[model samples]
Target: MPHSVTDTTTPASHPTASDTSGRTDALHSVPTGLYIDGVWRESSDASTIAVENPATGRTLLDIASATPTDGAAALDAAVAAADDWARTSPRHRGEILRRAFDLLTERAEHFATLITLEMGKPLAQARGEVAYGAEFFRWYSEESVRIDGRWSTSPDGKSRLMTMRQPVGPTLMITPWNFPLAMGTRKIGPAIAAGCTMVIKPASQTPLTMLALADLMTEVGVPAGVLNVIPTRTSGAVMTPLITDPRLRKLTFTGSTPVGKDLIRQSAEQVLRVSMELGGNAPFLVFEDADIEAAVDGAMLAKMRNMGEACTAANRFLVHQSVADDFAALLAQKMTAERLGAGIDDGVTVGPLIDDKQRRKVAELVTDAVDRGADLTVGGERIDGPGYFYTPTVLTNVQPGSAVLREEIFGPVAPIATFTDDDDAIARANDTEYGLAAYAFTASTARTIKVAESLDFGMIGINQGIISNAAAPFGGMKHSGFGREGGPEGIAEYVETKYIGINPLDATVRNSHTDAR
Candidate 1:
């Protein structure tokens, strides 16, 4: 059975009621200023940005938006802190990460609440987000100590060849609004674990969780200037300069493909090492022999997660002709039963979209697809609620080349299409340019292995929808973006490799003038 965040109870050692209240009050009332060099400083001027809880459409708090000057200060702090953090022993780094992880776990619920309020994910799901967020810190904590440099001996034992990994200096991490905690943690975790300092520019919509995380990191004894969190203006005021800064060695981001490409282009001038996990329009394939119950369960589970705002959500459902009708029928039935409301509501299974823009985009996609002759079996209308709520919609017989199938619809609209044969299914699945994740459901072992190999995706799910784990490298192929974000390969994204070799009197060294072909 899969573990759930709701299965556990808060321990006695957890923060007391008064402490919890105090933290919440502090989060709401305190200045949401730039956290640079272990201090909260105003963002140069009176430029303030208000953060809202998407669940209730209520104003949560207002924070100072980091201006160009603030961004520069953050970059400067990161550079100044990088050398000392890099020189610190790996074991000590691991300890710092471990303690930070413990602190995160202790305040998991409080942090989850922040995500629910700011990001509009259900409270239960928000807890799960925090759990996933904590896993990064825990995984990279041990990984920091395991960053081993290799050595090779010469034939005469008179010389040695050595290779080592070094932090790529100060990093600038720009996170998206969806999955606020996870996005920030994924980038910041590996960079910090590799002993690299960083400045984070969280999305303007959901900055509270990242801000709270920064406070927790500082509380856990992370050195001054090691991590700086700033809520920035949406006009790209501070963003443009952060990525273009010469001192910023690495730029990590999780966002749309267009913005990601633009950032890559801007950073390319300085040859900045870029690591991105961009948008994905993952395909969900259901073969004839698949376990219908399991496939249906997986589809609903994938769609409702974060209100289907995730990059790896099963966007295009490519079903075999034989079972296409059945899959669609069952999926629509399951989705229709899901209750939609606020995140704090215990009975509500699906919450609102992050904001008005996301809601409008989702609504437009559904309308466009329906206008193109697709059948909306379940929800097709936005629920009238206080927040940015959208009904979980299931569409069947969606035509190929429809807007829903071609574009990344980051919402709870499941588009279904039928295929006749394996070749046809594979061809149709590969039709899209986006290839972050692909799914295939099958009971036949042979078909499972074959389809898994044939799919052109970074991550594939066979007989299961769950694809993320601490041990597995997670990323995508094609426009879904480049680089990875998990496992041992994750920390490598923040490091550069160097090799050294020495020759002695007892060893034969190749002559510089000698030519060997």
Candidate 2:
């Protein structure tokens, strides 16, 4: 059984109250049954799994646990609606998506509060995520009308070749717990904007946010069976039928690399179109020529956002050997000032880990780094209380072989390592199985260009702390997984290319490399 967030004797009241207000009642009111055909329906199996509040270990509610039969039904709904939805004018699709964006903006704070209660991110940060998630809907809404391809003729001037883009059919959206709202909207926004039907499966740890998003979509008049959400605890049960079913043409996922690998193999059974935004181990490098104060500020924003649980969060800091001590000292001071408490609290800058399991993993990583001779500069222990938490930690004198740099430290742990120069810093930063995101601060334009071009990452933040936007591509290279999201290019993942050849006086077939989709 999960532990209670507050006293059981008190009546449920706002989550922020001492009674922890009726936040559970709000979750209970949400229809947890499988959403198919724009209607709430019971799963084939009546079993349900409890969703716990990560910060307090309290049972928020029980969501319907879907079986293979539920997966098939959702697939059937998507397949039946895909062609008709695709045939609808892109303007119409775009309009509905835009409306969703408007609704998200209007309800931003509500969603933010819900996110904080469920995922344990600070209320302020959760509000930011809600806004970030809304951007996808707005961006994709405009891109819907721009889904055009190339038109050209042969050199002989006797034949014409036409290429067009169309929806990739029904897709499955599997999102992780960290950015539950944003990831789901990122995938669904583009898929629907491109005229593809979808079934969303959010992480069980934070399904309420996605469910609430689905409810809003329905309010804005999304047609029957066009968008569905299946909130289930057992992955194999629902995913097996959905993946093996040939009707489901695509699978878009944001999660760990290992799970992405497994899904890739399973998706091969149907040759499914796949888009993966997996794990990351981002590096924040600060060169000697860089402004130390600016670097420190950037480190604070990059390393502490969402309590450093983001995939783009800085896992390790690589500082120029000369300014290493100063940077570490300043960073440790800022990190120590972070207030760790319940995310729902107004003044709580930093919140607890999602659960004891996650907290333990973070503790174990710090333990291993200390064992490997990394000196703990500040915060090396967990907080004692009813919540899952660890103090914001900083490590110096880190060994070259420490696992902290090798693995994704998805916690508020910042480890610093000194590097001789740009070449040394790039080598150390790029030395990992993941290449999701990397950042550097340098005053030299030539150095910035050199470092940016040299660093092996999909997204780079040079002289800037924040990089993600609705107009920028968000994804990674190498084992971090391919395919971009959040820009004009994001829509391409949900679209397939078709070539048309005409026989006039002569005929020919023209194809380009970008058409490899």
Candidate 3:
């Protein structure tokens, strides 16, 4: 994935009304140091990795990369801090989380700037991401003490059995670069609420926001080592040893399907508990009864979000034959009208790909699809420039066998196809190997419920484009990866169940006055 660094070229210079504002910040300064044991400290040496602004190919910051020794030390600190954090009162823990959430909201603009600089997302989108990230802490904070055990009556009526949920011990949280703040908070917030200390390894591509969040956690009085954010140049320094370590009881990740599987296999050495939110090729289904205008607008917002890097972003556009032509024409028009520019620039509707390699891969996929007979409707070429700029694209007449239809084109290329009838559409939607998220646009109550139930995806939105929220259980079925990452289910992922049994000496023995009454 390594390549020669090219001089950054700004897609555009000024901001426009269409551009998301307040998210961009000048990033000529370096943000160094790994946050370990509640302190911001450097790695053994001043070894640092340069982080680039995907929007313009500019070096945003130089972050300290932890070596193997530093990774080991972070783990040690987390282990040492686990017991005290677990013993802390649930109410107190919840208060700290709430405080962190408040701090994040108050400073949302700052974090959004970091996101725009490091991840190349629009200012508005970055602000929304910060809001979403804060929600995770808010939700889990209240659910922390709600964990409970159950008592069951014994068959013999002489004994009682009790079951309770307990923390899973020190955890290793690895987040992808796509939604840096959101993913890290999704994992660590719930883990902390469940009384588990953690060591977080954020994607080197975007580590500033995560480090900032760690600073906030410490400011809220979160104990040292209760949450450690270690930004490293070499992922193996943290991942390899931690996966095999016995003390690192749980491993949580949000990344590609291949990486998720690899983590699961490697964690088998200690039989570590794992929760993975892997790759998804979500299907955007449109029915005859659906509002065409609303659906089209929603589709653009959903498909283009994060430059289409999200696992839950709609990849396949399944339009009913009744409205296929109109839908495609409208979608193509919307895409064409969009002004492609840097994340910080005004009037910019779409940003560049994360890096040159990603841009090349997207270009290859589009070319392959075109070569295979798919119609390139709106976009199919990389913009002539220095940065990794890809035009917002739309394709039609895409055969089912085409790579565009079969694989996840993790860019702004939206290849649309048509289908007739409910069963056919549902079948086509569920045909893929990945099933993390899906969307259906319809007004028919019966069809809405039926299609939502029938779709093989974990998260489905009916007539609504926004599917992910802190209150909902976010995950997928089949190859999308196992386990949930939001809502009450998310916090439960960090807990272990224990049972206690009690036996009475005799049936009805020693009946006290209070017991008889």
Model 1: which residue pairs collide?
A: none
Per candidate, the number of residue pairs that clash is 0, 3, 4
Encode model 3's per-residue lDDT on 1-517: one tens digit a residue. 1112223333333312223443334332224688887778888877887788786576666678998888888999999999888889889988998999999999887888778778887777888999999999999889987988899868666788999898999999999998989998889788878999999999999998888888778889899999888888788656799789889999998988988888899999999988889888889999998999999988987799988988888899999999998999999998888767666655566777889988888898889878888888987877765567888889887877877777777899898889989999999999999989999899899998899789999999887778889988999878789889989899889999999988856657444665885
lDDT of each: 0.83, 0.85, 0.83
lDDT of 2 by residue, 72-124 (tens): 88888989998899999999999999999999999887788778877889889
What TM-score would every model get versus the actual structure?
0.92, 0.94, 0.93
Ranking by TM-score: 2, 3, 1
Model 2's lDDT to the true fold?
A: 0.85
The window of 10 residues in a row where model 3 has the poorest summed lDDT is 1-10
Runs with alpha carbons beyond 4 Å of true place in candidate 3: 1-31, 509-517
* TM-score for candidate 2: 0.94
RMSD of each: 5.7, 5.1, 4.7
